[model samples]
Target: MLSRRAALRFGAVAIGATAAAAGAAGCSSADDDRAAEPDPLLTALDAARRDADAAAAAAAVTPDRAGALAVIAAERTAHADALATEIARAAGEDPTLPSATTSAAATSAAPITPPTIDALRSMLAESQRGAAALARSLDGYRAGLTGSISAAVGAQQAVLLR
Candidate 1:
């Protein structure tokens, strides 16, 4: 006669085996479907570019804040470049080529109004939030890069801009 403990162990093992089989069978299609979804990093890259553009524009119109805005612009630009390189690498493309983000930004015809210091502050806060969230979802170097970017943006918003 089967013991209660032994039966429970057998059942658990059977269930686990069944689950593993199902997971393995589903993995290929899931991977293919996931490939169709856009990478979250692209959004982050675009935000960085926009923030850099905004900061540069703000600096141009608000001379008093140019010093701080220039720093923000340079940092954000660097962030954008890093993100673009990562995105390209992940896509198995040549990092030397201009990324979609860069091309789009360059061809963009929309005129941007120079923002006030308050507006720049708000934008930086938003960018920091997005970067922090993206950092949470990523791992490895991508995670560290975004985490660093978020921290820098936080400092910019809290200390530099203040």
Candidate 2:
């Protein structure tokens, strides 16, 4: 009774509506299981913190830029510490205990390269991407703490980029 295009569109909409109803009825998708796993977002933050530290160390800068980099690095380190503390708090562990596992990413002692503004630009770009990712991760973790961290990283990127 319907044209071919209209029939296809109707079928697509019907499928989508069915999927939406299933989702609203507490259906489980792969994405829904993300929160059940050990938080990958924490691992990502750990990696980003290391990268921020590396960037600060590698940046060839004047005194002003040096000061800014120092602040940025300190902020990043503080962010890592805060994340560790919050995670520990959630698990009823003493957050003060320095867990070696916190920084357990397998990274190399390789040197940072191309000591120039180009390098700085690259790091800034990377940091911005990390910030955006962290922001998106708010849904995967505790909204309060994760959102705060995302905002902090985003603000840091803005300052550093300027």
Per-prediction RMSD in angstroms? 8.3, 13.3
TM-score of each: 0.78, 0.55
TM-score of 1: 0.78
lDDT of 2 by residue, 66-134 (tens): 776767667767767777776666555687875544645324335555344455556555655665665
User: RMSD of model 1, in Å?
Assistant: 8.3
Off by over 4 Å in 2: 1-36, 59-64, 103-141
As for candidate 1, its clashing pairs are none
Pairs in clash, predicted candidate 2: none
Cα lDDT of model 1 by residue, 1-162, tens digit: 999999999999999999999998899688778678887888888889889989999999888888989999999999999998888888767889987756877798366788888888999899999999999999999999999999999999987799
Computed on alpha carbons, the lDDT of every model, listed in order, comes to 0.88, 0.62
What is the alpha-carbon lDDT for the whole of candidate 1? 0.88
Error of 1 at 9 (Å): 43
Q: Which is the leading candidate under lDDT?
A: 1
